[model samples]
Every structure is written in structure tokens, then in C-alpha cells.
Target: MGALTPEVMVRSLSQVLSFILAIALVLALLEGYVYLLFFRRPRALLGAIFTRTVQSAIAALMLLLFLRFLDRMGLIADLVAALGLAPLLTLPERVWAAWSALSPMPWRLLLPFFLILALELLIYFAGEPRPSRLGLAYVLILPALIGISFLIIIPFLFEVRLAFSNMAMYTAQNPEFGLRYGIENFIKVFTGPVAKDATFFEVFGRTVLWTAINVFFHVTGGLILALLLNRPMRLRGLYRTILILPWAVPSTITAMAWRNEFDFRYGLFNILLRNVQQFFTDLAAQAQSLPLIYDLLAWLSQAIHPVPWRQDPTWAFISVVMTNVWLGIPFMMVVILGGLQSISQEYYEAAEIDGASKWQQFRHITLPLLRPVLVPATILGTVWTFNRFEVIYLVTQGGPQEKTDILVSSLYKAIFQFYRYGFSAAFALVIFFILLLWSIFYLRITKGLRGVYE
Candidate 1:
């Protein structure tokens, strides 16, 4: 390629600036729309301020694009120094005039100053007319951040506004929702499913039970496995590899695999069942003279029967709990193994010198020392298992009957299958409170909070 000409660079800079100005104009228009339509500000100043800031930001972007297009990174810093710091430049006085006149809002000065500073940073990073290799890739990043921040801020504000109102789809469609503000949604969440005639207390109780049962089994099973593996035995490595496999595998896959294994017929369990024909043939052969064996067969025939493990209530509950408990152990085992290794061997040695039994040593020394690890893990496991839907859903589809359904799946069914989104949202809010209250109660009870630096 021939050496770059001044005319080519100027043309590129013009195109970049034009593109930047177009985007700025669009953003300023959006600011006015959001302020007037969504926020409904009593005064127009907020819209004007937002629009002006956005326009400035756009201009900064244009400058950087020009520098980057011209491949002149150093030129940008030099220009900023020359323009920003030149003697008797009158730049500060011009900037002060822009700030004062840009918005007649109460925050006019503060808003414009921050906006101008933000624009300056955007230009410095973008490297518009001259490109730094580093700055070229990042030229558009600052404006993008600003755009994303608007997305979050606007939605969050609207949601908060909605929280204080009785708005719905019909009302949200209009610029001014006809519905009035009230505390009814909050009250409704506490009272129960208003349409179903069930009280909120009932659902809350169900959630509490659900959380407790899952945590109980998870902790018990995990502790048992961890204890077993900690002991020295033959084939220890192989045993650990197999035992840890359940947690290493995805819970969704494991749940489904176990589900198929529990099928009533044509499953592994049923296929392994002893054929009655063999027993009958043996009985016939022995019947000619073996009275004692005949008597034993008669006795044994009355004792055992095939269990409908998933079909029946007692065993069905057991099956879900067992599967979740099994799924949880490997994670706990891995975490607990670290905790166990950290225990000072000196404690065990002292206990042994004092003639303490292994059980006594564990109860006295290990349990207390393990509390730090166990307490946090227990809390996390409880919360996660309470909301664990995939494992249980994939396992039973919350079925045989609805006996195994927990709050999360039940809420999902209510929303998706029944199309009661309003009710489900209310229910979700209730769940949030229940968890919050539980966490607070836990802290009060245990005095263990997050990031306790000491």
C-alpha cells in the first residue's frame, strides 16, 4: 500500500464523527422518551440532562473512533494534553458555560461535570484518530457499559414502581397504568393462595418441612460416607473412586438413571428376581421324601414378596430422599475431606494417651473442630437442596402421585402447567422471605455470619 495521505485520514475521521453523532442523537431521543413515558417526571429537566450527557458520551466515542481509524495512538494523548492543559486556552471557562446552560435541572452542574469527565475518559481509551494496538480493541467499550447500566437501572426502577402498585398486563400496556398503589400483593403472599382457599401458613410449613428433610438426609449420609472413607481398609482407592462417582456425575443424569432402575417391571431388579419355576421344580423333587425341606419351603414362601419401591407411599418418599442424599454425599465428602485433614494429629495423639476410644475422640475433638466447615456447608446444602428441582423432577417427575412434590417444582407446575403466573410470582416472593427469615434466624441462633473476618 502507498503511504497514507492526509486526505484519506480526514475522510475516515469525518465518517467516524458522523456515525458517532448519529448514535448520540438517537440516545438523546431515547432519554426523553423514557423520562416522559416510563418515569413521568413532573419537570422536563431530567430528560434534558440525561440527553445532554448521552450526546457528550457519543461525541467522545466519535473522537476515539477517529484516532483508532488513523492508527495514531500517541496523537490522542498529546492532543488531550494540548487541549486540556494549554495556557490561556479558555477551555475551563467554555466547559463551565456548557455545564451551566446544558440543563436547567437542580443537579445541572454536578450532572454535566460528571458527564463531561466521563466523555473525556471514553475518548482517551478509544484512541479515535490514531490507534494504539491496545486501545483499538477497546474503543467502543465505555459507551457499551453506559448502555448496559441504563438497561439495569431502568428495569429496576420500573420493578420497584410496580412493587408499590397493583399493575398487571392490561395496565402495563398503557403509558399510565390505571391501577392504583397498595400493599395488597404483600398481604396476599402472607395470606395464602387466595384463589385456592389455602392459607399462606400451609405453604410456608410445607417449605420448612421440605428444607429440613432434605438437609437432614444430606448431612447424615454425607457424614457417614466421609467417616467410612476416612478409615484405612483394603482396596481403599478403588472404593473411594466408586463411592465418589455419584457426586462426580451430573445429578440430572444420575436421577434419571435411578428412576429407570425403579421401574415396576422390565427393570434390572425384576430381571434378577429368582424364577418361581426353579423353586417349584426343586420342591417337587424334594416332595417325595424330604419333609424337613418341604416344611422350610412352606415357611419361607409366606415371608418374602416383591416390593413396589416407587409405587407405594412409604417407599416412594424413601426413594426420593435416598437419591438426593446419595447425590449430596460426594460434594460433602470432598469438602469434608479437606476439613478432616486439617485437624491437628496432636489432638488424636493426646486423646489416645488419655486412653480415649475412637468414638470418644471423634465426639469430643473432631466434632467441635469440624464445626467451622460443617456449619457453613450445612447451611448451603440446606438452602440448595430446598430449591433442588432437577434431581427430583427428573427422578419421579414429582410422581407415582404428587406426594414427592416440593415447593420449587410445585411452584413451577402452578405457573407453567396452570398458567397462574401472578400467583407463582407471589409464591416466589414468599419463598424469598422464608429463606431470608431462616438465614437471619440461623445467624441469631449460631452467631455465624458471612465474611466474619475474625
Candidate 2:
């Protein structure tokens, strides 16, 4: 019993079945006509294959539509989708296996006719929610929820479509097949300038450089500091605390602090330079103002001077990389320090007994043992730096010109600045595959065949 009774439900469901039958019949007839008109000549050699595919597809649609109508009509009251009780969908899949392929329709479809007749005679009046369960609404809405699974699969198909197709509607006249977009975009991604005049590949390459250089300095410097702090020296606790201060401070604050410190005027750097330049004597001579790194470049370019640091392309690139390296170091230092603590003292003692030089011990023991932790950290650091926009953008703004745009920042420009959703989506899809392919390649190379982990 429901707000709408079983009788009312059956009446409404009957009408729905009639409506579905009409639609199905119309579509089948229309597609059949279209196939007769257009799909005829292509069937010269593959006629059997084409016919089989068409017939099989059509039969499947018909069977699903029939099952759906039966479910609607309360001919099968179990509503757990393919798991529904009493009548099941497997009847079609199973019984159809024995039917002749050449037949117009599967002889197995006859089973449904008798089954439905017997169903109507039996308790066709049974209701849902498993008959004893409390949630009738759950049962009623179950199929709609199942339908959404297919809905979620659509965007992936669209991305795949774009990946394969040239995608410009104006490319040619009514092309039957997907046009040859080629690996041109893919190649462009790795080369330079993905779109228009701006070169994102160079930006991305610089980003990678930033990552590698940053990690190398960070690990070495962090390890040295960590080892120093680990010793039983005076004020060791205070020194350790001071060393970690850079990492513990918020990144934005640290970045702003560095930005101020690098200012052209009233900054420590210029003051220090002026003191050092005056033969280390004129501590009281008025400290000369050095141009800010970027400003200095513009000034020098005016005077047949050194290449620009922030405006000239090469200098601008270097400044950004240096800043990124500076920003990234503290984090790596902390991670390495943690890794160092986890290594056992026994290895070092054993190395000493074997009369291995410190360098030799480090080379053979430290590096090989550290590889397990460092490899993952290095790879993660690489990806993070590759996509790092905030640090570079806040500092460089891709300035002088659009000379410093990485793939992601460049993608941002395309989406918001250029209003190219499809283009950007395609770019994102490409990047995703690039990362996915790299991951797959790494996994294959690494062969993550774990034995046992507690």
C-alpha cells in the first residue's frame, strides 16, 4: 500500500510501457531505414559483421527496454537492478546464447512471453523494498541512481574524443572521420609555446630546473645543519630551534620577508655589498643603494651592462628559478633531517670497523639506503615545482613579457584570459596523460611488487 496504490501504479506503469514501446519501435524503424539507405555499400565484404553488430545492438536495446517495461509494470517486483529477485535479466543473456545468429530474433525471447503470462497468474501483485524492508523510497529511486553511473562516464568519453580529434569545427568540410590533430600538440607541449607566442615548455623546463636545483641544495644544506644540530655542542637545543624557524614560519611570510630583503634600497644586501666593496674599512661611509635585482637589470641594459635579471629574458628566468629554489629549501631540509634520524647507528659503526673512508661510506651505504625515501620525495618535489605557479607568479608575474609561463599557469591564461574552455580542457587532458604515462612508466620500471608489509 502506498500514497499511490498498487492498482494506480499498475495503470500508470502500463501507460509508461505503451509509451516506451512506441518510442522503441519508432527508433528501431528509423535506424533500420537509415541503415538500409546509408550503411548498405560498406557491407560488401563486412556485411555479416555489420549485420551481426547491428542486430546484436538492436536486440540488446530491445531486451533492456522490455525488461525496464516489465519492471515498471510490476511484472517483476524485485527492484535491486540486476540483483532484483524472482525474474532476472540473465534470462535474456543466457537463453539467447543457444539461438541461431542468422535468425531475425532470438528464439529465447519466447521465454519472457510464457514467464510474463505465468507471472500475471501468480502474485504479480507483490510490492518492492524486498517486501519486508522498511525503505520503500529507496527501492523506488534505485534505478534512477543506477542510471547516474552511466551519466558520470560521459565526460571521460568526451575527453578521449577531444584527445583524438582535431576538434575545430572549421578545420574542414564535413569530415567523416576524426581529423588528424597529430602529436603536434603533444610535441608542442614538450617543445616551446603551446599557444600563440607564449612558450610554456620553456617555462616548464625552467620549473624542472628549479625543482632539481632546489632539492639538491635543500638536501645537502639541510643534512649538514641537521648533523651539526645532532651533536652535543653548547646551546645545541637553541641552534636546532633556530634552524627550524625558517621552515616553521609560514611560506607567504617568508616569501614577503625575502622580497623585502632583496629590495633595492634600505635592504641588508645592498648595505653589505657597499661595506664589502669599500676595502672592508668604510663601515661609516654612507651605504650605496644597489638597484633591486629586477631594476638593476633594466639599469645595466641601459649602460651596455650585464644582461637584465628581471626584464631581459635570460635574467628574468634565472631570478625566478633562484627565488623558487630559496623558497623550496626549508621544507626539504626538515624532511631530510627526519630521514636522517630514522637511519640506524649500527651501519656507521660497521662502516668504521671495515675501515671505509667517510666519503666511501656515504657513497655506498648512505646513498643506497637513502634511495628508498629520497626517490619518492624527489619525484614529488619535481611534480610540485613543475606546477608551482604561486611562488613564480607572486615574484615574477611572468614579467618583462610572457616569457615565464609554465604549463599550468599558461593553462590558467587560456581558460580565463583567452576564454578557451575546450582548448584548456584538451591541454589538461594532455597533461593528465603525460603524468599518467610517466607514473605507469615509473611503476613498470619500479615494479611495485611488495612482498609483505605489517
Candidate 3:
């Protein structure tokens, strides 16, 4: 929290260097032991020992340099104090305090490191005779694997632990963990309100509807535009660029802008509707002699009144869906466009020669060929839309009596708003399983992976 200074920078750099050197030294010793155990030739053993000695010497020297640098920067005392090693404490007291601080014995951290070392040894042994590329692949991907473990897998496991606990604002300091707590959390998720007044089924049903509507419009609208752009046309690039602007802009910004545009009196939608109604009224009066035309214009005028988009629950839901659909279309269009272009012109030409209509060609050829691209895109789109929170949160915020709350937004509200940490974790797991099941069912039904594998 303190301001960055030369001393802080030097200390941080020294800590990082020391840690890296320590790891290098450990790895060198581990590899040397593996070599001694595996290689029977005295030459190989001597080479391995020499390599380990050189690596260990370099790492130790680097560690010493970092220590000296930290000492010179006057940061050694600060580091010791940070580690709870008080100057007044006897050596025994310091050791005891350090042991107490590490009471839980970070097996979670050590287990992974040891497992990785074992895996590397196995890979090395396997690859020794035939120089397998798999070891190189693992080395290249090790950083990403570590990142995913820390960022995703670890957090997911922690959330599962929370889901099994009775943790809330009241019991945050000492939450009870048990199978019974997990059962209660899951049961409450289904039976009790997720938000203040919205039940789990109600919010979930709305989320399904929301995802469906947005995905439907996104696919259809993007496909239509892609089809048009696929044909020969002047300024097609310009038109495509303009159409994609909604997606190019950030969703939060677009949602806020659309939220403003849904304003009753001053919004662009209302203003346009009001102008249309007035124009229709004037036309109806002028066309009164023709009763049919007059009635049509009058009806048009009556139907074109400004809507209370934000105030009404249904309208607010519609507003968020519309914003999301707009925000989602460009991605679909780009994906579909690529798929469309990938379809060989020869197929269309042969279909045309066979007297197939446009629709017939699309149904018989284009769709089947595009399935490989479209199915994956649709699945991704569905998942993204189902979990989408920005538009709803920014636009309506599950407003008008929590009417627009989806599962994700409701989960967020439960945690941050209601302080129902345990409940929210359970809610999150439910949503995850729902999406997982849906993806599995969808893939099976669509044979989406078959196309990819084939």
C-alpha cells in the first residue's frame, strides 16, 4: 500500500530473484538424483554431477547477490519484521512463531510442486531413448497449466468448500462446514428466494428465456446481414463495418447508452415514436375521405405511442434483451461470415444447375456445410449469453421488483448485496451444472463434435 520507492523496488526484485534461485537449486538437485538412479554409465553420472554442481553454484551465487542487494538497500530488517521475526525474540521464540504461522502446513502448495517434479522425471525418462516431443510440449505449456490451476481450479475448489459451509455475513468468521450444510444450501437455492423476492426457478426460467431470445435474434440477425454482405454489393464493406459498430463498442458503454435511449420522454425511441404518431394523425385527417386509409392511419397513430420501457417489467426485460442482442450480433456475423465464405462456390453452382431454389440450396448444402462452424459458435454464444451480466446489471439491474434478474445477476446480488456467500456459491455451482448439462445434451443432439472430429 505504500508508495513505490527505490528501496521497495530493490526489495521486490531481490525476493523474486531469491525465489527463482531457490527453485533452480531444488530442480538441479532433483535432476542430479534422477540421473544417478537412471544412468548406469560412469561418464553419464559424472556429467550429471558436474552439471548439477555448476547449476547449484550459479543459483547460490545469484541468491547471495540478491541478499547482499537487499541488505545494502536496508530492506533486510523490513523483510524480517514482515515475517514476524522480531529482533527482541529469542531464536527459539522466532522458530516457534514461524511454525505456528505455518500451522496448516501448506500441503496444497507443496503437493503440486512435488507432483510436477515427478511428472517431469517420468517424462525425461520416457523421452531419453526416443526424444519425444511431448516433454517439450509440457515444458511450453507448464506456465499456462500453473496459471489455470491458480486462477481457475483453485478458486473453483474454494467455492465448492464455501458451498458446503453455512457461511454468511453473520457466521463469516466461523462458518460451519458439513454435508448437512451443503444439502441445506442446495435446498434453499431451489425453494427459497435467490434475490429478495425472486425464487430460483423464476430467475432461472427468465434466464433461459433471456438467453434464448437474445441468441435467436443474434443468430438470425447476424446471418441475414452476413448473407447480404456475402453477395456482390457496392459499399458492402462500409455497411458491414457500420453494422458491427454495436459490437465493436464495449457492452457496458452500449448498455448505458441504450438505457438512456429507453428513457420515456427524451429517448430517441420515444421521440421517433411520437413523431411517427403525429405524422400518422396528420395523414389520417388528410385522408378522411377514404375511410379505409383513414382508419388504417388512425390505428397506426394509436399504436405508435411511446412505451415505458424502464418502468414496466416486461419492457425492461425487453430492453436488456434488445441491448444484448445488438451487442452480440457482430460476433455471430463475423463467425457466420467466415463460415459462409468457406463454403465452396462450386457447391452453389452445382445446386443451381440442379434447379435448386435459393432456399433449397441453403437447406441442403449451406447449412450442412456450415454446421461445423455454426454449431460451435452457437454453443459458445449460448453459454456467453446465459452468463451475461453486464447488460442486465448496467441497464436494468434486475429492476422493477427484481423482475429482470437472471441466475448470474441473482448470484452476484446474493453475494454482494445480500451477503449470502454460502448461498451464492451454491447458486453458482447450480448454474455451472445447468450449463454443463445443457452443453452435453446440445452436443449429443447436434452431433457438433462429430463434425469437428470428422
Backbone clashes for every candidate come to 15, 1, 0
- lDDT by residue for model 3 over 27-119, one digit each (tens)? 554454344334422235655565455446545644554454444433344555676644433443455567667756455346545754664
Off by over 4 Å in 1: 1-207, 231-234, 268-304, 309-313, 450-454
What TM-score, over all chains together, does every model reach? 0.58, 0.52, 0.73
* Best-first order by lDDT: 3, 1, 2
Give per-residue CA lDDT, model 1, range 370-425, as digits (tens): 89889889888888987887866787766655556667776766566655444455
Off by over 4 Å in 2: 1-196, 260-309, 449-454
What is the lDDT of every predicted structure here? 0.62, 0.57, 0.80
The C-alpha stretches of model 3 lying farther than 4 A from their native spots are 1-137, 446-454
Report the CA-based lDDT of candidate 2 relative to the real structure.
0.57
Candidate 2 is scored at a TM of 0.52
- Model 3 — which ten-residue stretch has the worst lDDT? 33-42
- The digit string of per-residue lDDT tens for model 2 on 387-421 reads 67775566666665667666677776665666444
Using lDDT, give the best candidate's number: 3
Q: For model 1, give the 10-residue run with minimal summed lDDT.
A: 33-42
